[model samples]
Target: MSLAAETREAVRARPFLRDALRAGLVNHSAAATWLAERAGLDGDSDAIAAALRRFREDLPAYETDPRAASVTMRSGVGVVDDASDGDGNRAGESLLLRVGDAAVVDGGDRTAILATGDVDVAALANALGRLAAADVDIAAAGVAGDALVCVVSRRDGANAVRVVEAALDAVPVDEN
Candidate 1:
C-alpha cells in the first residue's frame, strides 16, 4: 500500500486524531511522527504530514448541534440480570431497558436519567462522555427513537442530570 493510504488508515484507526484534524486542533508534524512510530508507517514525517493535510482537506469541519429535549431524572431504578429470556423481551418488571439477559427495572437504588424528544444516539454519546468525565459510573444506557436513558447511582443523579443536559445542549453532529 502507498504511504498516503497507510497514513489515512492510521488516522482512521484513532477517532480522536480524525476529530482533532477536522477541528484544526492537531499539530500535523507531531501527529505524523507519532503515527509513523505507532502505526508502523515506513515513510518520511514530511510526507506523512502532507498526506494528513490532504486528508484533512477532505474531512468535514467539526460541528455540534444543540438538541431540543426534556431531561428528567427518575430515582429507584435497578439493574437485574437474567431478567430476559435472551430473546430481547423483558420480564414485565417496568423495564426501562433490556439487552440479552440484563434489564434496568424499576424500584432499586439507582437513578435513571431520561431525555425525550429530539434525542438520538449522538445525544446519548455526548451524555455518556460527560458522565464519564465527571467520574459518574454508568450502569446501563440506551437510545430508542426520541428517547435516551442513562442509569447511574442514586447519589450521582443530580450531577448526572446537569451533565446530561449540558451534553445534549451541544451534541456533536456528523457532517459527513
Candidate 2:
C-alpha cells in the first residue's frame, strides 16, 4: 500500500501537525523526511507530499463525521475537488488580514482566543512568545482567513487574549 493508504493512523495521532500541514505552515518535504526516519516509512518526497496534500484537502469535508468517512482512491490516485486541485502548488496564495478585536471563549477544560482585524503575523508570534514565557500550555493555534485562533489552558485563556491585544496594539502603524 502507498503511504497515503497506510499513514492515516500516524497522521491522525498528531492533530496539531495535521492542522498546520493543512494550513500550509509545515513544509511537506521536511515532514516526509521525518516520517521516513521516525516511522520507517519510505517513499518519494513528492509522492508523500502529494499524499499529505490530499489528506489535508479531504480533511475538512469529513470534519463533522470523520470516522464515518472513507478515503476514496483509484489506481493509486486520489480524487480532487474544485477548490483544491491537489497539485501541491500554493504559489499564488495570499494571507488574509485579521480584523476586529480578539475574543476569549471558555470551553470548560480549555480556553480559546479568536482574534480578527489586521492580524499581524509578527504580533501573533510575539503573543505566542508571551504565552510561552508565562508557561501557558497552548493546545493548538491556526490561521483561518482573517482570524488568528489559539487554544490554551482554561486558566490562561483570558490572559492569552490580553497578551494578543497588547502585542497587536504595539505594532507601529504605517503613515503612508
Candidate 3:
C-alpha cells in the first residue's frame, strides 16, 4: 500500500490516533515514538515521516493571520429547534464552550514548540506575558504528555523561543 493509504488506514483503524494527529498537538517524532511503543513494534522513522507529511498535506486549507488569536467557543443560550425537554428550558438550552478545530486553522508559517521538562504554570504564564509584552500573538497552546505544545506566528517563533528559555531559566529549581 502507498504511504498515504497506509496512514489513512492506520488512522481509520484508530479514531483516537486521527483525532490526536488532526489536533496538531504532538510532534511527528513523538507521535512515531508513541505509535511504536503502543504497537510494541520497532520504530520506523521513514514510515512515520511519510505518514505525517501525507496527513498534513491532506488537511484542508484555512488561511488565517498568524498573529490573530485562535477562535474560542463561547457558551451562551442557543435555541433548539425541537423541544426535547418537556420544560421550556429546551428553548433556552445552554451551549458548551469548545476549542476550535485545529484542522480548520492555518498551519502555514506557524511554529510548533514541544518543551519537555518541569511545566510550571507560573513560568508558562510569565512566558505568555512576555510574549504579550513583545506582541507575539499565540495561535494555540496545549499540554501533550510532559511537553507543552504551542503554536505561534513564525515571525515571532525565534523570539518566543528565546523568551520561553529565559523564563524557564529564571524559574527557581527546587532542590528535592
Over the stretch 1-176, how does candidate 2's per-residue lDDT look in tens digits? 76887555567776556656655676878887776667666777677767777776766421211111111111111111222225533234321212232222221355556676655455456557677877877765555546676667656766776676665655422221
Model 2 ranges off by over 4 Å: 61-134, 137-176
Model 3, 1-176: lDDT tens digits are 66456556665576556545555654777766666566443438567656766786675432211121122222112222343444433334332211332221221456654456666454555567666888888766654334554557666677777766665555432221
lDDT of 1 by residue, 37-127 (tens): 9999999999999999999999999999999999999999899987865665554568788776778888799999999999988899889
State the weakest 10-residue window (summed lDDT) of model 3: 63-72
For this target, which candidate reaches the highest TM-score against the unseen true structure? 1
* Pairs clashing within candidate 1: none
Better candidate number, 1 or 2, judged by lDDT: 1
**Candidate lDDT values, in order:** 0.91, 0.54, 0.51
Clashing pairs in 3: none
What TM-score does each of the candidates earn? 0.90, 0.37, 0.37
Model 3 misplaced regions, further than 4 Å: 1-107, 172-176
The order of the candidates by lDDT, greatest first, is 1, 2, 3
lDDT of 1: 0.91
Instruction: Tell me how far candidate 3 lies from the true structure as C-alpha RMSD in angstroms.
Output: 17.5
